[model samples]
Target: MSSNPDNGPAVSRREFDELFEAVRTWGRWPAPGRGAWNRVTADHVRAAASLVRTGTVVPIGRPWDTRPGPDNTRPALHHMSDLGDVEPPEPSAYKDFLGADYHGKSVTHLDALSHLAYRGLLYDGRDARGSVGAGGARFGSVQELGPLVTRGVLLDLPAVLGVDWLEPGRAVHAADVTAAERALGVTLGDGDAVLLRSGRFRRRRELGPWDCGAASAGWHVDAVPLLGERGVCLLGADGDSDVRPSPVEGVHSPVHTLAITAMGVPLLDNLDLEALSAACAGAGRYAFLLVATPLNVPGGTGSPVNPVAVM
Candidate 1:
């Protein structure tokens, strides 16, 4: 419950708590760390593989951001270590190194369950302060999620509305999600990966970069329960999935807290889904085989990833 103002989506603490109780998956899974990813089995992967009709592959990863701006506070580092000009080598080799604080607007990344905490507790009721520290997370680490292979449903909101992109700060409600599903000719189901595309990158390319942290079109807390009911294993978006000026007062990222802490679902953020949207539209289908393999960093909260969709 935010005490800031009643101007936006006002959610009392009681309501948020009740929602948390209703969706919490603590003690439900056989293993402790895998969370909702456990829903996607071998059968799901095999079924997902059947989606590759044209063998069209679309990459949803944003370009490595090396330029600093209001949105990219910590630009990714990339430099050539060897340029094939040294040591009198007949067969000269070229090498490069790259690095970044990837958990921001500039990078396409996956957020593990450890990334969000509510009321001092991480997903599965683990003590946040006790489990997560300088070394990294002891529970809900990205390594535990491994590779995700499932049917992906694209909710292209802008396309559904016949708009270039949704305006920043526009809150996407459950109704909007359902409408997009109907319009896109897709239905989300168990273990499916639902990607909401707001055309953030397209808008940025056209209008130039703005402060995404201050304003972005994303999910409202009200949308989480709908997704939970659909049993979607993974959620992603062009934005970080929380509507700016968060409908919930006091909570900076209520959707993050709700989806990760309450629903035990991982998230993919800052994706560039423009190409995928076009590919799906041209194919007359919005569903595809989505594959994402995160870096296996033990005790890590999340990982920078380049997710791919095959249609």
Candidate 2:
């Protein structure tokens, strides 16, 4: 293993592979496509709903970014299809078109089980090349996962540590997760969605956009087992879940590989958790009802989303 001053001790490929095997959930769920989401039952939704007190709904997605930046290399596309200039019509109409390559830092999106692969294998040991093709994913498509409504536990690291935001490349270790849970008065539970808030946007607003792909605060590989043990159905973050300048060598995104490819847990990436953080702080609670409905694209690997949290 190597080490970085910002991200701490690095994990070698051997260590990452072992960690992947430790969290692998192959053949564990009856529905391989749904994966960990199957752990959420009707009771879980009802219980999550019960947590809504003030009925304050917070959207956790960032505004659709159309401008190119260091973080957003492939910006989303938006243009007017109709400007109400059609002739001979009784009524004029305006329309627009939208398109995105959302599997990057700019867009807030959900990652289905097909989004990542480790050693040419997807979750449940599906061969990536065979399962996913030019048409899209066959085995773990986003359509299979559908809508997700569950209890969301916000691990507000900035609040717990008395910082505005964790510095870029800072690794959120397993101990940090437990400490935040204790400080926030929330505990991880079965079928819950864990949202880690590093206050990335706050820093971006105060400073400026940086290449999050190059450096960002996020989960270290050491944290995956704790989440796996807690049976978290989903995972998300202000930044993509894996700490940039990845602690794991030979893996650009080890957390994505471990959580989505090995553990069969889907992920929400590039969320705007500032509002949700304040809402939780005001409510004196860190747990709330989270509702995320992905676009039902039959063979899509994932979809852009604006997931909501109700408290």
Best by TM-score: 2
Model 2 ranges with Cα > 4 A deviation: none
Model 1 has how many clashing residue pairs?
Answer: 2
lDDT against the true structure, each candidate: 0.89, 0.94
lDDT of 2 at 260: 93
Model 1, which residues run further than 4 Å from truth? 1-8
Minimum summed lDDT over a 10-residue window in model 2 is located at: 1-10
- Candidate 1 per-residue lDDT over residues 1-311, each given as its tens digit: 44322224668777877877987889988866788888989999999999999998899988899999978999999999999989874888999999989989899999999998899999889999998999999999999899888999899999999999988888888899888889988888999999999999899999899999989999887788889999989999999998887766578888889888877899999999999999999999999999999999999899999999999
lDDT of 2 at 310: 92
lDDT per residue, candidate 2, 165-196, as tens digits?
A: 99999999999988998899999999999999
| Candidate of highest lDDT | 2
